[model samples]
Target: MIDLLEIPGFVLDDEREELLAELRAIPGTAATVLSQDMGGRVQPNVRKTTRLAVSPETRERVKEWLMDAKDVLAARFGVALGDCEDPQFLRYEEGDFFVPHQDGNTPLVHDASRFRRVSTVIFLNERSGEPRQGAYGGGPLVLHGHYRTHPGLRVEAPADPGTLVAFRSETTHEVTPVTHGVRYTIACFFRAADAP
Candidate 1:
């Protein structure tokens, strides 16, 4: 049961396009290659996308939005989350996808990797209210619930521009392959302020 709150008009149309242009200039290999949480290795199979450096002005806006939504998130996820990591902007072109995985912990990996309390993905692209109007095809954020207990339950969060979806980091989720246009997004990971 993931409570995905759709945030309309979070990023204005102009701003989104500006950010997209900045990402397009970077070479895929350099911008997209990032270390995985499991083994600290750069892997594209598990997660593939380029990281966009967010400007300070944009960061301030996001931080304010997060603070304003704290209560809603806390009530929905049943946890007091604080301190969000600097979000990474990601661009997913045709055939790109992220395999199902949890963001919280990975067996023996210590350090700051254990603090991911909440996971967030903010979509950036004009999305028509109609399903067919989606600029890009596929790339739905599929949340895999407990199969046995929550039997046959799955939540699909479409990548619509200006939409924000947040969930517990422990939940298993994946980004389905994009069949059409490129998909742009920002990944935000939050940690509990008081965690050890």
Candidate 2:
């Protein structure tokens, strides 16, 4: 079944960390991260921006890790993982904010080439731990309400460093605006399907 699992202190290798840190430090592209969806409308907030990073040296190692995660998930939960690709680290700059939205709940948002069934986000660094250039709210991940026609539930998750959170892509979630500094995270989407 689909659920949210909190894995404590899931830090990558030194090489992986180096690659991510370097990438996040680079100049962003086209706003870098995608802002949160505001009931199908984008309010446009700076607290949310994704780096969507990758390097030739790091992709392979990350891919292998995801593969291992998929295998482990399947064996433990009896869920068939179709494919996993493109591990990206999302960086949210100061004053940035993402609206409330679910990963796969909206067909309106583009779908993944590979079946994206489950989505995972791992925290790279704590917002408080980072340097605060100017005073601002910490970038906290918030869940507005559950996706249900009849009833809805609220989910709130803070972007704690070294924590890995796995949940169905359909979970309604958002990133709270950061008054100052940046929030770093590693994000990935997973698909489940029959064996090839």
C-alpha local distance difference test of each model: 0.70, 0.60
Indicate the worst ten consecutive residues by lDDT in candidate 2: 33-42
lDDT of 1 at 112: 69
Model 2 alpha-carbon drift over 4 Å, by segment? 12-17, 31-47, 75-78, 105-114, 129-137, 149-152
- TM-score of every candidate: 0.78, 0.73
Question: Model 2 residue 25 lDDT?
Answer: 60
List the candidate 1 regions with Cα displacement exceeding 4 Å: 28-39, 54-64, 105-111, 127-134
Clashes of each: 1, 12
